[model samples]
Target chain A: MNKRVGKQTIETPSKPRIIATASIVGPKEGEGPLKDYFDIILEDDLNGKDTYEKAESSMMYTAVNEVIKKANFKEENIDYLLAGDLLNQLTSACFAAKDMDIPFIGLFGACSTMTESLAMGSLMIDGGYANHVIAATSSHFSSAERQFRFPLEYGSQRPPTAQWTVTGSGAMLLGREGNFPYISYVTMGKVKDYGVNDVNNMGEAMAPAAVDTIAQHLRDTGRTPDYYDIIATGDLGKVGKRITKELLLEHGFELKDNYIDCGDEIFEHERQKTNSGGSGCGCSAVVDCGYIYKNMLNGKFKRVLLVSTGALLSSTSCFQGLNIPGIAHAVAVEI
Target chain B: MNKRVGKQTIETPSKPRIIATASIVGPKEGEGPLKDYFDIILEDDLNGKDTYEKAESSMMYTAVNEVIKKANFKEENIDYLLAGDLLNQLTSACFAAKDMDIPFIGLFGACSTMTESLAMGSLMIDGGYANHVIAATSSHFSSAERQFRFPLEYGSQRPPTAQWTVTGSGAMLLGREGNFPYISYVTMGKVKDYGVNDVNNMGEAMAPAAVDTIAQHLRDTGRTPDYYDIIATGDLGKVGKRITKELLLEHGFELKDNYIDCGDEIFEHERQKTNSGGSGCGCSAVVDCGYIYKNMLNGKFKRVLLVSTGALLSSTSCFQGLNIPGIAHAVAVEI
Candidate 1:
């Protein structure tokens, strides 16, 4: 059976199961609406570490370990660890991976790392590359701010379009044979540049890519929006969420009943003062692992489309006046 | 049929073929001994670009396009493009990927990205995920120096142990069916930290990882060093090459013959003034794609073990006094 469908999608002949998942967040995200769903909520963003980078690494280490523990497996049992973070050279992920004995592959999809890891893990399992793989990602608000934008000590005022970088980590353990939410299909995305260069407006930059991937997935799978109980985009905030909806509608598909943006829902915009909403790799990661996965297990949703969007640009590129390019990968999960 | 042999290795049931490969390098690399093997050699390191980052991106874009053309496939025929670079957030790779319409998966294995991409690309093809995939990576001396160490304007004298980052790019097109070098097996790597904190001596930091992966590959495949015509490590340079050989000897495996390090062979040490020799993601990449792959086609080597080593550490981690973690992945290529 040819697993590939249409152009950029792959339908797994043997669905890859998400055996277990874990999420860790800082006090800010813990105060969010989905606080009860997170496994570990830190009292401080630094988590007692000397630096924010070290703290982020510690969080990721905990998330990876927690996910493996929840799967009832030891460190040695995991065949591979696919992970990444927003920091330069994926500092958090590489540092966290150093503590584990699992063979590791480092990925970088910015915020889309959550679904990128999930999609790659699923493909690896279904392709017989591994029986079990751990997909994880982490992000720290302080670290990201210093690296991507302004320094924490600078006390810069963010634009209304700016999204808060979530300080958290998420991990999912995937297996070939398991009774869990099965990854059925994957739609890989092409880099799309909509001529948006403002780093502060990542949501606007990434929204088109989210819509592009969702539409491609739908077309490839021959399914309508109704086929999925929930349609989720990773970190596209309120502005990007609305833009995605409008783009979908323009394509003759309306996401009327089931639509969610992880960034938009992670926090209360007015109360939390997170500008547009939560962002970063951990934004969508914790939402999917802590909230969505839990609800799927509870039978609240039987089918879901996860479109994890990423704005792929560096500070150097932005400084060099290059347009921000966005990419989004979609994964179809069924219970 | 199980494909997986032993703990950390995967033996492809249907060996994926390297249908086509391309390499582009700067003037210094072109002046090297293996210059004859490279496809395109730029007259200058800048390659007429405003910045070294853009130059690196252009080199990668050209390499990818050339490989696809050599493979007799159009841009749309490519199923996926797996690429990365040493820059923060993989700017060169992501920027280069913007020109292509193929679905892109950005990876980061540092210098090991060359073999890591090949391993994943091979698995995707053998696992029936895609008929064709392209693995590519790039690195520029000026760009990597500015990002990882001092600015080019700093003009600080390099230590004797330091290696010159290669200014080059390499791309390989893998297909399910093709008359090319067959990818027979892959040995994934575990992150190994030896408490080496000196970011300048990446060779020493990454040597142990190369030895570890090579030992695991031998153990997993149940093969002796004699099985392979060439056992190569990517960008480990003279220091790392010696350390790797010494470590392998301590592990009861003697690479008595047919052992090579891509970094050691890429440049003429004395003439090039590259103290410890060439090092970077592109060092191994261009060597593998241009020199080794071409020689293999000409029957100079039958079976080879290509192990690409990486010292996974960010400048922030180094500044914060963290030990460098090393990783190396191996792929078996046969005629």
Candidate 2:
């Protein structure tokens, strides 16, 4: 029986010209979760909307404003503002854009926001619409804790497979032409329901979803993992990593050497105690903007596939008895 | 010094594909603010969020779930969940996507979210990264009011330039070869900062930003508004609309016949007591998915530019005495 691969083709005469890409983090990289690149800090205060809202808004607001300030390109050059955050309304990014003298368009892609925004921004550029696009997102412990998990002072112990949200902000400049990567290729993962049926252990829940998308990407592009200097998934913790490796090998493909997960690389130190890695829109973003982009500039990696992953689940859904489904999009960053 | 325009080129061996797009609303035709689409029985208790926390999330949850249900695309087939909303952290979109069991990528484009999502989803499809992508955003009167204006029950009269947030949802199936009009082109508006120093009136504040981008699009694509059956901008209200018209004429281009603004179209009947036109991410979205799309399919229109407008601003910024800026993105829907 011949099964359909579920593919469709259309002629889209669009070329998104990336104007630029930028990023910001707390004072220290991985030293403090909340200190990645935030200009404003919450001193362990777990205030409800009172503190969390401002902190979240402030960090994203700062990063976006800074990127705009540093662009050298007039704010008038920016055609649309595409931004997202780990928080609810994407308030920080949205509000920050709102406060600016320039107008905007916002987005939400969890830790993969920058990529999402860039993907869209590139569309506008490719389609011969606008010349400049700004994509941004932020993550904060104080803000994310209250929204995604517990309050800041809740002191919830994370499982070894658990990941940390980076206290950082990433912004990219995509113009008709600039130093930014031209979004060489993009591959989206099908939403996969691994049916792990374990919310408490996200690794088991999301690992298969990650593997399926990664494997599909290789198949679709007809390129081996060896083609990329780094084949990075957005965030898959320790257990997910174990499973991803195993699944890749089972499929007659091996990527033990150059395949790196953003979470694992960002929080590799014992001090972080993040046995799995760092997760969140900021996690993969910081690595992408701060680490990966820099590495590409230095010619350390020639071709890279950035696979940002997101888990679809909410507190209510968890309460309503739902399994975690995961999806990923792969962006090929080439020299 | 010579200012040179740069080029961001997209080179691919093959054409990229689209996965899907979805939309929901109250009425199918003729815009009339919130009353048209949603089965909105104006209740004194009608609120966007139950509390400040729930305001954004609940609205996003409603739209996301509605799209998921309507699309009938199983969550497992959805590789990437792209969403954005007006709340901080993109709470509603994020929270909504979190529960659906698909990996999520959040977005924030203030009012231009729906178009922004489409652009990104199209890129993922074109890039052949993922098989499917979901893009959505929502705004509730109660939710946005509390965050950006007075409380949900604020009896204060709205300003003429204050457009109502459509209490509805929209989604689309943007597959590579779907029957729906392909998101063939996307023209980004230049981030123009004409420095409109108005906070209370978004229409006037956003007019220049709209004109700047729209005019540039004509130049970039070298197509007159006559090239499209319908040339529409999202929510530029009555005041901004006239100026946009004037600006176009000044640029030797006029979209007199098929030109329309989502704000003017949605608030046509509400003129007696309207401040601005309709606002929020769903304004253009509801129109696109509901009226524009259907009209295009029915032969009332052929090539249409769904220009979604956005005012990037926040309550905090307004409180801090900052001016309101605007933006718009044009999505070409071809039959």
Q: How well is each residue in B1-335 modelled by candidate 2, as lDDT tens digits? A: 11112221122212332233344443312235434443222232233334533434554555555555556766666656666666644545655664566655566666777776776666566554456666677665556666677776757776655666665556654545446566655554434455665655777776776777667666756678888889878777778788889887887888686888876776554543556667677677767766676676667887887777777665554554545656676666676
Give the per-residue lDDT digits (tens) of candidate 1, residues B1-335.
35678999999878899999999999999999999999999998989899999999999999999999998889999999999999989999998888889999989999999999999998889888888999999999999999989988989898888999999999999987757899999998999999888877889999989998999999999999989999989988899889998999998999876999999999999988898889999999999999999999999989999999898988899999999989999999998
CAPRI class assigned to model 2: incorrect
DockQ of all models, two decimals each? 0.78, 0.18
* Model 2, span A1-335: residue lDDT tens: 11113231111233343344455554334354333433333343222335555555666666566666766776666656777665544556655665564445665555556566666565555544456667777777566666667776768887666666666667766765555455665554445666654544665566666677677667756778899988877777667777889988998789867888777777654785665666777767767776777677677977887777766555444544546666566667776
The C-alpha TM-scores of every prediction are 0.99, 0.68
Shift of residue B242 alpha carbon in model 2, Å: 4.8
lDDT of 1 at B324: 91
* Span of 10 residues, lowest total lDDT, candidate 1 chain B: B1-10
Error of 1 at A58 (Å): 0.6
Docking class for candidate 1: medium
RMSD of 1: 0.9
Evaluated with DockQ, which candidate comes out highest?
Answer: 1
The residue-level lDDT of candidate 1 at A122 comes to 91
TM-score of model 1 relative to the true fold? 0.99
